[model samples]
Target chain A: MTRPSPKIGVYGFTGCAGDQLMILNCEDQLVDLFGATEIRSFVMAKSDNHEAELDVALVEGSISTEAQLKHLKDIRERSKVLIAIGTCACWGGPQAMKLGDGKFEERYKKVYGNAKITVSKAIEGQPLDAFVKVDMKIPGCPIDKQEFLKSVSKLVAGKHPYLLKSPVCLECKWKENKCLLLDGKFCAGPLTKGGCGAVCPSHNLPCVGCWGPTDDLNVSAEYDLLKEKGFVPEEIITKIRKFGGSGVMELVKNLEKKEAKK
Target chain B: MMILKMKKEDLPAFLESAKEWGELWGPTTKDGKTSYAKVDSLSQMDLKATRTVIPPKKFLYPPRFTMFDFDEEGFVERTGDVPKRILFGLHPCDVHGILIMDKLFLETYKDPYYAERREKTLLLGHSCIPDDKCMCFATNTDFVAEGFDLFFTDLKMFYLVWVGSSKGHDLVRMRADLFSRNLDKNDILNYTEYRKWKTAQFKAKIDLTGMPDIFELGYNSPIWDELGEKCLSCGQCSMVCPTCNCYNVVDEVDLGTAEGTRDRFWDSCMFREYSVVAGGHNFRDKRADRLRLWYTHKLQAFIGEFGKPACVGCGRCVATCPVDINVATVSTALKEQEVGK
Candidate 1:
């Protein structure tokens, strides 16, 4: 017998709320999703959101604080499936830049400057999976609607989410845009995942590696491409480390040593 | 392939014939720039402009269209009967832009909204004599010339009208008084010669050969950091492009009520927030990366699949960029980069 509709909950943390807004922006599909499932919670859209057991909990934003970490633990307890929605939850978002800024208190004091940070405290940002096992990640700064819907439908039907294994380069190919990289304009599509349907490229612009690094992406090859384009080691290396940070820094250390050997 | 002649003065009767179907929209003055607007008087149409500041895609895929509205009862599609109209005075680049849209809306997932609008409207393409920035010829997309219903090639005092569709032929029949006797071979030759001269008038050109190879090498290129520093993330390049079609959908609800209207608005990759998903995986987490993505997708990799550059080379990006970062300049820079030694 088909079980009753799975209860789904959507939450947002301290990002631009673009991701949650995007889900609500899926107005047509939102109607169908509501009818198809028991929406246990959605704070951004609806007032009546539950903090109880959920089939799926799509958390957006980074757990940047002790309180947020506790809440993430609770969400993991109640959620059978934890789906990280935006960049913050997936790859620590833009705020992840603070990882290199040393301690949070120093920067926090600098930003707040003797003024009380009476709100929740924060630490360096990290992806949600660092705290709790993320069942699936629908990556985008704000997830693409069509792709999001497909993932949601699949999950609700008790199926594994279909990840976009293709690189941003593939989708850019589909959009038929000019290659900014080819024009000596540095772009990072070659190593980024495809999900945004190559939106940036279609607009006569470049991909910024927003979907984060994909498994199987030829990062070394892309590095070589950027190097050949006459990009400085400082610039290209900085671009690569924006998301991966320490991981990339470590990778670069190895590369530098390898190059030194040559 | 029939060529007919019409005096520049008889443009009124032709527009009047267009009104019999739906609204007649052409390039008109708006916000100190030429934009495609609904027009009645022929005097309001700016036929002399290079291209409209706003794209013709607005007519087909409007930025703020309500795809649907929702309340407790159910969801209701906001479908209005499409009004047949004549979209006239489009430059070659804009015309090419619309054809790309036709491919997008019709050939792909089949957007009913655009298809409905397309079925109702008649496209009238006006050949561009081209200005200093035109590079459609360099991209080899000056014209396959298939998208428009009617094509008008201006030959001095007279207009060479090429009936591109049955609708165009019907339009001519309906407005018979506007035309003189059918044109001979000389008009076609003269128009072709004029087009060739117009292509040559462009001040910039880039050899787009092996762009993928060049781009494949440039992935680690340092040029992005230098150029990205100039990108203010203001999204002006996207806002002005004839073919930049990225968008974000939003829901506008009243304070007291949950009911709302959903609207699709144009969005740009340049926005810091464009890629920030709910859980926060900013794949392109850096300005440099976003900048790189914009250029590579346009000239290098998009060609790997689409068989043509996504850019129509309307130079709207050049015209509108606040920083004056020109693609022509960038492409020339790419040409300068040599492969690995």
Candidate 2:
């Protein structure tokens, strides 16, 4: 007997929608995906979007507004497996850096200039997990196509998708590119999670921590490392906070406390 | 070795004739970085470049080398699909690096995949003039006396070619029109003098006279932690190092299908996952431990086993590392520091 086709929805909130574009970038592989599962909703690709319950929901972007939060919770209730796609959905992305710096209001006012928006009320962008539980995450500035296919195929087969817990340093080694960090440029490959196939490093560019911190990253040690390398405390924190999200701020707090005690 | 001379103007024609050898690969500029690539024409080759961003080792040992295809009915071995090729204009250090890798791949348990590529490929070595970043002189790999099919040293208006092997002699004979019997005694004298002058040009130096002893005694040195603090554990050193042949074998099964493949890709000792074993225990858990292991392997363990350190001092690692965590600096630290009580 043929297995029932999986019902899936792809949604976006407050990000570049680059992850959605990446899914479409899998042009040849998307045919296989289309055959294997029923794509119920993907506004980026098709117009016929369904509102019914889904077996799997791949969400892109972060929750930055009350309206987006409501929509995210609704999607969570309807989907059995909710996978956060992209750094925006997974770790709040670049927008979350202001929150980490404790200058969100200042930055927000600078942009909007005291004008009250009548549309959706804006809150600091947050990872999908802040509002509802995300079953899995595919982290990247824009999610990698190969990784997306791997996870989607696993979900289609009713199996749990596995991701490497190691940092980008692992893949960077495989590619054998010169380390950007060794040139005295700050690279976060050792701290950020592996899965993007170390793309930026392969091109001899520093990893901007777009994939967020790895599971076992020693943030305090990394902080000390930057300091030892002659980077100012503020400079180090700001560099990490580029894509580090609020978790980096917590690590900074812990590091400051440890330093004070010493 | 049969010594021959070829004029600079005849290089295009000579390279064009070299097509009979197989696919010609030499350093070419791409994306503002010089890397070894397939040269379709004379203009595509940049033999004058100091060092390529990536070495010629990839031709012999590909990044993703497939070992076999498997199913429930055993496996089908991935036989020699290697094309006949010539890796031209390889720097002396890179040539030396290939020789070092041969110790591992060509000896003991022979890797058929690597062996096939090795057998099919011919190395055309080139003499290099060292820049500030080079330490090949300290590593004694600056000038290769052997282990190449042909070695070319640029001599102003001409190229002094040393046909080192029977294969090289065959190629030279095939393109005899490009060669000249007019090569005089002074040309040979100039070649020797130029090599001596080129060797003296290297600025970076590391005294590896007591490396094994230093590495052994400096096991508990605080330098490892200091270096570790700066290291991103990105494995860029090993990746760019031509002699680094470490890899992980993985059996990747196609989703919803029984067919699978046994593939091997490059692995790094710097990675935390590299030391992780069964039951989820990582022996080299700390970043410092991993960094120490990498340095020890390159400078000590390999030397103890192979009678020579694995590094060829190509300066690729020095030039590529983002944090400027140089191998020479680490070696100097080990040599200068005394073992703490």
Candidate 3:
């Protein structure tokens, strides 16, 4: 008896499309992917794609326009499992960073001042979860490929994906690498999630908190440490707010008060 | 193990004798900096030298070597066979990095390209002749360890060599009377003293004792943003790092045919495109995170893995980085923070 292959589709939105490229990056497992299941749609990888009800739909990019909102709702309706891939889809990626500093009209003016812009009306770009419920999220600017394939293959086999959140600091420990802390190398491995295999540190650099803060973290303590280093409260908040943006703004107030003491 | 003291006059003979075993590649002076490349004459081998600009890992894992040739039709071909070559003149820090990479390639996915080359090759280590740029002592990698067949220490006219494996003994056996004939406690102690002298020469100016406290506090330090403004994102800091092994795997078509190879080449997380997704989503999209990620991995996360920082403290990143983002300066700033805290 032959079993029916699952229908899977991949979609993208308004971004550099590097995350999807990262998936295509798995050259070895790609053939295995084609062999395992029926790829219903993947705009960048293939031209011939179906848009019917999908067993699993992997989406990247954010909701920047009304068209994207309608498309996301349709995806949510049709797909059994909707996995948001990359930070923009999972958490508002880079574009979401400029929330408060200015209005869209002003910022747009600054970039394309007073031009009759008829491209797409701005609608505060947000993660997919904002428009439609996300079953699971594979975070990162572009999620790590090994984990991505494992999830896709698992889904194809009718298994749940194993999401990792052990923190980049844990992988650092696993490698038996020296703690940059002892050398006074201020690092956020404790706060940020792992799965990148500590690539930054291996290059004699520190973690920039790109993987996003772990679920269980002491953000305040790190704040205190920075203050002790004589760093300004505004500077520290702006740095972390790069990835976490609004998620981190609330924490900035406490930091500023601490800096006021001295 | 037998050892013989080769007279300074017989250095060329020693070089020629070693060639019978295999092609010996050591430190050759290029533009006055010690770089590992093929050499024919003994004078070309900077016997008394500074550290090589690049680690010998490049020989096994070339910066952009092809992994294999593959085709659109799935005709997978692998270039797993590596030539038998001898790599000499590795500093202790570099030797340590080689051992770490051995764990990466030999253990996990069984990287045939790295492992195949590594298995067929011999490793030779040399002690450091202290220089202002050298920082092995900062990471405690100044002393020789395993991963080398022959370990050479410069003792003025004569070289103190330690044969680690069978290969080392074979090299020593080839030269009957040139190397020291017998090993005694005194000779071992003399070498130990030389290593200690080398350590004193480096004398890591900043103590690494209070790293955790300093780093924990420096987590929100303003130095990163200040430095981020100057960064070019060229990834030079990552390129010259001995332990930095991030790579990008790519598929290419062979000639005009569908037959091509999938290969993994060195990649840096610093590049803006490193974390970008096809959907235009970038998690660490900010320049600060890129800068922060580099230091965090080296300082905090690397410590969690290997119980040592990933950086060899070679200052190559500082030298090569277009922005001059020096880890030493960062560490000093953290030290001051620890005191302030």
Candidate 4:
């Protein structure tokens, strides 16, 4: 008996919708991929999408509204495997920066002076995993297409694909690219996750930690390095929070405290 | 040494013919960044490039090289396959870097991988006009005395070539039509004048007056702490360094098949795991300690072993560092510091 294709759904909440566009950008391979996987729901790609039991759910963007949160819970319940794609979904992106900074309400007023968002109850941005279980995370500003494709294929085959746990420095060294940090340019490559193929460094640019912190992140080393480079604690904290999310920000605080005591 | 002249226009034809010798690697421009790349024709060679972001050391010591392929039966180790390769447009400082690297790799424990490449490769050196960041003159490596097969000095109208080796002599013999033996006393004087002019261009110099003693004495100096504070531990300084030869080897097995390949890639001392041993005993755990080791290795330790510092004064480290950590400035700072008598 011929088995039915895996029911896969694509989604977005509060983001630039760039990650979904990245999937569409795979124009050449999308046709073959569509033939293999049963795309049950994909708002960005098609208007004719139905809510159904999904084998896999590829999610992008941060949850910033009460409506989005309820919808996310529904999707989570329907999907067997939920994959967080992009920095927005994995770590809440730039929208969630203020949540940790303790200036969310003030910034909200600054953007919309006393005006309440009517479409949905406005709430602070949070990653999908904060409310639901995320089986895997494909991290990047706009998730890397190759990595996304690889993860999707592996999940479809019921195989657990082991992603790189190392930092960008590993691939940068492998590419033989000169370090921008050595040139007195601030780079987050040493602490940020690899699998981006060291793209920024290959072009002689610094990594901005868009892919988030590596598993073996030496927080103290990075903090001390930034501090040595004349970056103040506040400035370094801001840099870390850019893509690291609240967890890393907390780790940064701990590292700072240890540094201060020393 | 045989002296010859090749016109500026004839360089392309010469490089095209040089392909008959081996695969050619020279400077090429892409996305506003100029770097050393394999060239098929003269047009691909960016001869006017100041310096590549990373040196041509990758050709000799690649970032990731397969040591050997193995099966379940037994393991086999093989030397580097760097077939007859000619690296053109290398500057004098970089040429000197390879010579210094030779002292380390070719010493008591000869590295078969490096040796295989060294034996098969030919270096073509060129006189460099120093820019603001260049400190080769300070390190006394601006002009190479030896270690290159061919050295080319740019004279206004033509290139004044000096055949430094029998390999270069054979090239001159093989491509006799490309060169002119019509050299006079004026050419020598012109070359000397040009060298002096180029030497005067380098304003940056690392004064070694008491640097050796200063480096030795300043082991416990607070400067190391300051360096550690600013250093990002990115290891880019060593990556761009032509003389640095540190590497790590790992066995990678193909998941589908039982076959595997032992591969070696560039490793940096700045890494936290570089000094980590079994049972997680990290010797150089602190950033300051790692900084001290790097500076001391390049300045003091290398001098003790090779009678010269490991730094070739290519200034790639100084120029590439994101934090503007200038080695020359650091040395000068150390020299000027008043240590406890």
Candidate 5:
């Protein structure tokens, strides 16, 4: 007997729908993806998206508004498994860089001014885990296309998708690219999670840490290396904070605490 | 082992004739970085290069490759298609690295992938000038005796070539006029002088004496933690090291299909995920623990098992590591109980 295809829903909240676009960009694999899985809801790809119970929910973007927070809860309630896709949904992306900085009000006012009544009140951007449980995370600025496809296939086959947790340096070395840090560049390859195939470094550009921090990130070491290379503390922090989001912020805070105790 | 001499000018003609054996590959410099690339003749190669960015192991065991293509029915081994190639300009330490690899991949369980590539490829060793990073003297691998088909030693006016195997002799026979077996007293004196000059040129003083004992004594030392903190865990040292041969395998399924190809890629013990197993139990979860395992394996465990350290002292780690955490630094730190800059 043939197994029934998993019912999947793809959703976007506040950030650019780049992850969903990445899925669409898999033009060669799209036909097979459509044929194998019952894509019950993919608003970006199809119009007739039903908000029904789903076996898996591929969620992209951060919960920035009250409506999105509510929508995320509803999505979690309707889905058996919710995998956060993209840096935005995984760690609040660049939008949540200043999270807990206590300057959101001033920044919001500066950007949006005094707008009248809105459909949903704007709130501080947060990852899906802030409201509901996130079963897994497929991280990138826009989620990597091959990783997205692999994750979907693994989930469909009733297997856990394995994500590479190593830093970008591994892939950089595999590509045989010269280390930018060795050349006195402020490369984030050693601190950021890989799986982008070391794309930036392969092209002679430094990694921007867009895939977020690796689990075993050596923040202080990276900071020290950059500092030794003549990068100011402020410049290093800004570079790390660009896509590091809440995960790296927590690590940095913990590092500071450890250092203080020392 | 037939020792012959060829004039420096006739070397290019000999190399041109040697191409009949396979695709000639040698160290070629690009953008100030040297790596092995296909070359037409000796003139296209940077024979003076100290070391290639990636070692000769890449030709035998590639960074990544498909092992098998499988559907729902069965797995079809993706063997064959390995082209016959000649790898030229391998330094003595690199040839020693290949010998260690032979003991690992060509013996015991025997990896067919590495075996197939090894069978097809021929190693052509070349003499090298000792740079500041060269530590092969400490490892006693500065002059290789085996593991290469041919070895060429530059004696300024002429090249003293050692025909290591029958294949090398065949290549020499192809260009018989370019080579001469006649050797005078001056050739021996010149070779001795060259060895003396090479020995004095080593600037990196890496002594691996009693490494196993030192590693055992310093098992729980705080130095591991200190080095771990500094280590990026980038695995660049492993990638560039001539003797590092760790690999990881994965089955990549095609989208929406059960069919896929099983692929093998270079893996490093430095990676946090390397020691992770089922049910989320990471054996070497701490970077310190991982760092200790890598060094212990290279300097201690491999010594116990193979009677020699896994590190060939090619100085790839010295050149590659960004934060100064290499065999030289780590071993020195263990021995001296102090980390060096």
Candidate 6:
């Protein structure tokens, strides 16, 4: 007996819809993707979206508003498995760089000076795991297309997706690219999680840490290396904060704590 | 070993004739970096290049390639289309590196993929000038006698060619007119003088004497943690090193169908996931542990199994590592019990 196709719903929240656009960008595999799964609710892809129970819910963007948070909780209740797709949902993307800085309200006032009424209350951007249980995460500034497809295929087959946890340096070395750090340049390749194929380094550029921090990274070592290279501590932190989000923020904070003890 | 003398000017003609056997590949310099590239003739090659960014192992086991294509029926092994080629300009250290790989891949439990590539490709060794980073002298891989089909030792005006295998003799026979069998006493004296000169050219002093013992004794040393702290875990050293042959295989499935390709890509022990087995238990989770494993395998474990260290001392690690955490530094640190600046 043939089993029915898995019901997958792709949703987007506060950030730029690049992740959703990435799904649409799978034009070549769009037919195969549609044939392989029942896309019950993808508002950007289809007008007729069903808000019913889903086998898999792929959520993009971070929770930055009360409405988005409530909607995410509802989606979590309805979906059997929830996957955070893109850096925004995984680590709150660049938007959540200042999440723990305690300046969200001040920054909000700086951006939009005291607007009277609003459809939803504004809040600091935070990853999906901050509010609800995220089964898996496909991290990137915008998730890699091939990685996204691989994750989807595994999910549809009822298997756990195996993502690489190595840093960008692995991929960079595989590509035979010269290490930017050797040139005394600030490169985040050693600290940033790979699966981006070391795209920036392949072009002779330093990694921007857009995929967030890898687990158990030597953050203090990287900081010290950068500092030794004549980069100021503030400058190094700013560069890391560009796309490092809360994951890297926590690592940097721990590094600071350890340094303080010394 | 059949020794033949060839005039330096006749090299291009000999190489041109050798192309009839297979596609010619030699070290070619581009953008200040030397790498092995397919060349039509000797003129396209940079024979003076001491090393390529990647060694000849890439020809046998590529960085990444599809091992097989799979479908609903079954998996189809990808064996065909491995082109026949003559890889030229390999240094003595690189040739030694290939010999170690041969014992690993072609010996017990032979890897058919590597075997096929090895069978198709012919190794042509060349003499090199030792730079400050070259450490083959310490590893005793500065002079190779066996592994390659042909080894050309450049002695200024003339070339002393050693034909190692029958395949290499066949290439010589194809251009028998260019090679001279007439060896006089002067030629022997010239070769001796050349050997003395080459020996004095080495600048880097690396002593791997009792490396296995040193590695064992320093297993619990705090030096590993210090080295690990400086190591980026980029695996660049592994990639550039001639003997690192670890790889990971993944079965990629197509979106809608139950068919795709099984890809094999280079993996490094420095990577955190290298030791992670099923159930998420990481065997070498700490960077220090991974660093120790890499050095131990190269210096101690391989010596225990093969009676020789795995390191060819090609100096690729010395040149490639960003933070100076290569074999030279690591070995020196172990011996001195202090991390180098």
* DockQ for the candidates, in order: 0.03, 0.29, 0.03, 0.16, 0.64, 0.58
Between 1 and 3, whose TM-score is larger? 1
What ranges in model 5 sit over 4 Å off? Answer: A109-114, A257-262
Give the least accurate 10-residue stretch of model 3 chain B, judged by summed lDDT.
B252-261
TM-score of every candidate relative to the true structure:
0.57, 0.81, 0.55, 0.71, 0.97, 0.97
Give Cα distance to truth, residue A133, candidate 5, Å: 1.8
Q: For residues A1-262, could you state the per-residue lDDT of candidate 1 as single tens digits?
A: 2547888888887567888889889887777778777888898888867789998898998777888898889989998888988777787766675455457777777787877667777777777887789988877877888778777766665555555554565455433344466577777775576668778876767778777765434345456667777888778866766755322444555656765787
TM-score, second chain, candidate 5 = 0.98
Candidate 3 lDDT, tens digit per residue, B1-341?
Answer: 33445555766786678788778788876544567777886767885666665667777787666666644355544664556777777778788878777776788688777877887778877667766766767776677557788877777666777677888778767876677566668777876787678777874475565566567777778766655544434354565677777876755432112344565666667665578787979877665677778877777777877687777666666544423465665677556642111
**Model 4, A1-262: lDDT tens per residue?**
1346789999999888989999998776787678768999999999889899999999999999999999999999999999888888988887766556677778878999978567987888988888999998888888887777666655554556545555787678656565665455678897787779899988887888998877546567677666766778787778877888744767776776787898
Residues A111-170 of candidate 3 have per-residue lDDT tens digits of 877677686666777778877889988877667887787667556545455554545654
lDDT of 4 by residue, B261-288 (tens): 7778877787777888989898998777
Q: In model 1, state the lDDT of residue A239.
A: 76
Model 1 RMSD in Å is 10.2
| CAPRI level of candidate 2 | acceptable
> lDDT per residue, candidate 6, B1-341, as tens digits?
99999999999999999999999999999867788899998889998878888888999999889999988788999998899999999999999999999999999989989999999999999899888889888899999999999999998898999999999999999999999999999899999998898889889878999999999999999999998888777777888889999998887776666777888888889988899899999999889999999999999999999999999989998888877888899999999999988
Worst 10 residues of 5 chain B by lDDT: B250-259
**What tens-digit string does per-residue lDDT give for candidate 5 at A170-233?**
8888777888999998899988888899999989999999998887888888887888889987
Tens digit of lDDT per residue, candidate 5, span B208-322? Answer: 9899999999999999999988988877888888888998887787766677788888888898888989898999989899999989998999999999999888888988888
* Model 6 root mean square deviation, Cα atoms: 1.7
Candidate 1 lDDT, B142-220, residue by residue in tens: 7646777888877888887877889888889898888767667887687788877876777765666677787788888
Instruction: Candidate 6: give the clashing pairs.
Output: none
Clashes of each: 65, 12, 76, 16, 0, 0
